[model samples]
Target: IVLAPVSLAAEDPLPSWRDGPGKAAIVEFVARVTRQDSAGYVEPHERIATFDNDGTLWSEQPLYFQAYYALDRIRDMAADHPEWKEREPYRSALAGDVKGLAAQGKGPVVEMLVAAHANVTTEAFTRSVAHWLATARHPRTGRLFTEMVYQPMLELLEYLRANDFKVFIVSGGGIDFIRVFSHERYGVPPEQVVGTTGGARFELRDGIPVVVKTGDISLIDDKAGKPVGIWRHIGRRPIFAAGNSDGDLQMLQYTTVARNEDDTTPRLGLIVHHTDGEREFEYDRESAVGRLDRALDMAPEQGWLVVDMKRDWRRVFPVAGS
Candidate 1:
């Protein structure tokens, strides 16, 4: 049989990606599921795609953006609470010592986060996050946190949506915090964002019903919890899932790996490997935040695509002016 000549210009969906196996897999998969004549063609409603926010969708270092915001909040609130100066985690966070806080382990860190984030109404918290995101700049790149989003991923989101896929962000970050910027920056609406949630209460304040954030642990949407969050919020199993760390392993598995004997649907799992130290942060396995150890090892065995940032992406963030 004679083969038809393919037009590179006409077929390029992810233009920011260099020609490679990773990019080829994405294009081919999307085509196979979206093409009318293809056996794997899926209906629009079944085209659910979920992505992790930090590191996967945008930069998550020198630390997770939410953690940075929490630290900043703690510092801002320190003047009102002089006791923080004598406290272990608060003192370190106030001094801008991230390593010191990490040394104290997850307990102290969670305490600090709760102190900084809770006890406000949902609306108030949303506004606070909005203002912080608007003003806060990433120390390394000197770019606004929202501006640090990956351009290639932004294109991918648009590309997926164009193919009738509904994209959702399933992250370990705070749900409210991510909702504040996810819609405006990533095109993923607040309703489509599923993340770690803090306890909330309904209260009538001055005759207005308000939902207030309480200092209580709710869902920590990471690792095994990712799949649980997906079930609780999304209701439908995603056909495509992307993440950057071991924290996202369960999410990738839930989306791609077949479970029951009766289930048969094409799925894709992608892991974003941070390999570009020059343009961005290079980290995996040994890193404190966004560690990619278990997920990295499992990707090959599961047929998941691992995107090498330095090799696969033609560009990291969007152009300075653009």
Candidate 2:
């Protein structure tokens, strides 16, 4: 009796990824940590993977899609606060001048949106975001912002989850904003997302309990804050971390850098390098949004795998309707 040969292609976990060092590295790391007989085996409960959302999992070009959301919100609010029509940032946002609004820096743009969210019921804010995501299309791609998420990363997330890894999103974008679509887009639930958070005030609104955004940020989950957010939200060091910019340097270090001499558990740190200008926008070290500078410089020293977008991903955005 003879048996038919098995197909390796049918078992390829990350089909969107090209056959290259970056994809091979991720597959190898997952195999090593999940194999119970391997020395690098990690318990399912301890397998935490944190990813930076914007450039790491999705496209962050022209401006962060969140910034675009905020800009649109500013325009919507202009009717309520007519003074905003003349206000600096508001004026630019009202004009749909993405470059002008981005020039104000991500911080100010973040603050602008949070301010709009201020004093509103959490339910209301969530609805507004949901509405925007449903209707708003990327300025360049003409696809909905959520449609721009990286297919390779989505496959990576699925691969990790199949191995029993708990994935969390740690980003500089608004926590409340990301929560609106995190589960639907990345299969990551709201609770697993940790990001720049605004202070909230709990109060009774017309016989019901409500939480209102106070326009006061409690944390900015980027750069050094990333590690702190991970600790505060997850309560444990991540075994794997992925990011795309200098903002992720500290988190990468926190994940891969050994705490002490005896800490020898296998760890992985990955950086998504935007090298494909034809399929995607390319900027690093010098670009304002999602700048990948020092992190790129130190990736080699840190044993981090820097994935070149042009070379590693067979496709960037998910195919429509897939």
Candidate 3:
């Protein structure tokens, strides 16, 4: 039988990715799962894919974007609370000393987050995050935080969606905060976002029912909690999962390695290794935020595909106008 010549433009789904093991793995996996006659073929509904937000989908270096938002919120509210100027974390945060604030450890950091984000109505908080995202720019890149997303991963998300996979953001960031931009930035809807959450209470004010943020921590959504969050939110096991740090280890394991006796579907787990200091930030294993040690150790034995950003990606962030 005569064969039609293939169009490289039509066949190549990930243009920003270099021709390497990482890119090839992704392409081969997608092809296998989408092929009708392949044993790895997955039904459209069963092709659920979960992605970690912070380091996997976007840049999380310097600090998580949500933390930056919290710092901004503190500054926005500083005039009302003069006492914060003398407080531990708030004082450091107000002075723009991220290092100092981090040095205070998790306790003080949590206090700052609660003070900035909690005690507002959910609607008001949503509006606050929207305003922050509209105006805030990353300190180093000077780009809007939403624009700092990995271009290759953006292509991956689009590619997955094109293959009829239902993509979801399973992040350790605040659910409400991420929901504001996930739809516009990643094409993942608010309903598909599962993240760390604070307690919320439903109340009636002015005869209108509304949800208000509470100071209580509801879910952490990192480390082992990732799987728990996935189970609680998506209800079905994802056939594919991608993440960047050790916090995402359990989610990767849950998606790719774990299996029930009755289930025999193919799975893919991907880890994005930040190795491009010039293009992005080179960090792993030692960084305070998005530490990747354990996950890196497990990737080889677990058969997870690790994408070395400096080597595997032709572009880190999207080029201007593209």
Candidate 4:
């Protein structure tokens, strides 16, 4: 089987990243890494950058991707198990009444996650993820799940790569789930993605090595887990980081700490603040899913760039259908 070659050329593509502090920081970092005579000049292999998923790179409005996966799983598995039609959360999910389920609160949602996520073999889980991503559409927008990616972030990714940065997604979302479409959508291949993962075991299927998913859960990648996941998966510390909300606090902290160790090569951290209610949901300090309280408080003190989505993004989605 032949895979398309990954791109490793081109100039910094996001020169228009704006003239604010964020832009200046990024430009300075690039200059340092690229200068042959600079003490900060980093070899290409050392240029690691990590980004959090969810609201950081896409509109995680309405709900998270895992929630959507759970709903769809219930819907798909319901036909075989007729009892789900009468089950509490499953019933609501089957009826397309997510609000009703949410009204019942986290209990129902957790039940759904346990039922849909646990006890499956890793291969089965991957297959399930593939099936859902292939078929699912955003309820409100009616766009494919992969198509919901933020255009500006996509540009930033390309821009970073042009500057010799090796971009990786250290997200709380499932690794395989995001990997399914990230290569096509974000130009980030599956091998570079790291996220919260379920259990898996190796087996011999027809004398060939195969990975099976265990019903057991391993890690929940969120908040403090972000840095842990990055450390475990990528090994090398990132010189640049970007994320949204308090879930990304530890990641930003880790990146900033690296900057202090060596002043020669500047480290970069940016936070995406949800401020566009018309284009996407906007909330701070109190939203259940993507609460940004800690990040907002830390942004000023930490010198982390807080990106105002409304003010910064000229375009949100990719030309509606481009």
Q: Whose lDDT is greatest here?
A: 2
Segments of candidate 3 deviating more than 4 angstroms: 1-9, 79-88, 103-111, 260-262
How many clashes in each candidate? Answer: 0, 0, 0, 4
Worst 10 residues of 3 by lDDT: 102-111
| Residue-level lDDT tens digits of model 4 in 195-249 | 8766777878779677765544466667788888888888877888999878889
Q: After superposition, how far is residue 102 of candidate 4 from its true place, in Å?
A: 6.5
Q: Give the TM-score of candidate 1.
A: 0.92
Off by over 4 Å in 1: 1-11, 82-88, 102-111
Selected candidate, larger TM-score, 3 vs 4: 3
Angstrom error at residue 182, model 4: 1.2
Give the alpha-carbon lDDT of every model: 0.86, 0.91, 0.87, 0.76
Supply the global lDDT for candidate 3.
Answer: 0.87
lDDT of 1: 0.86
Superposed Cα deviation of residue 284, candidate 1 (Å): 0.5
Q: Report the Cα lDDT for candidate 2.
A: 0.91
TM-score: the better of candidates 1 and 2: 2
Pick the winner on lDDT between candidates 2 and 3. Answer: 2
Screening candidate 1 with a backbone cut-off below 3 angstroms (N, C-alpha, C), the clashing residue pairs are none
What tens digits encode model 2's per-residue C-alpha lDDT throughout 101-190?
A: 767766777788888888998999999999999999987889999999999999999999999999999999999999999999999999
TM-scores for every predicted model: 0.92, 0.95, 0.91, 0.83
Instruction: Compare candidates 1 and 4 on lDDT and give the better one.
Output: 1
lDDT at residue 220 of model 4 (Cα atoms): 61
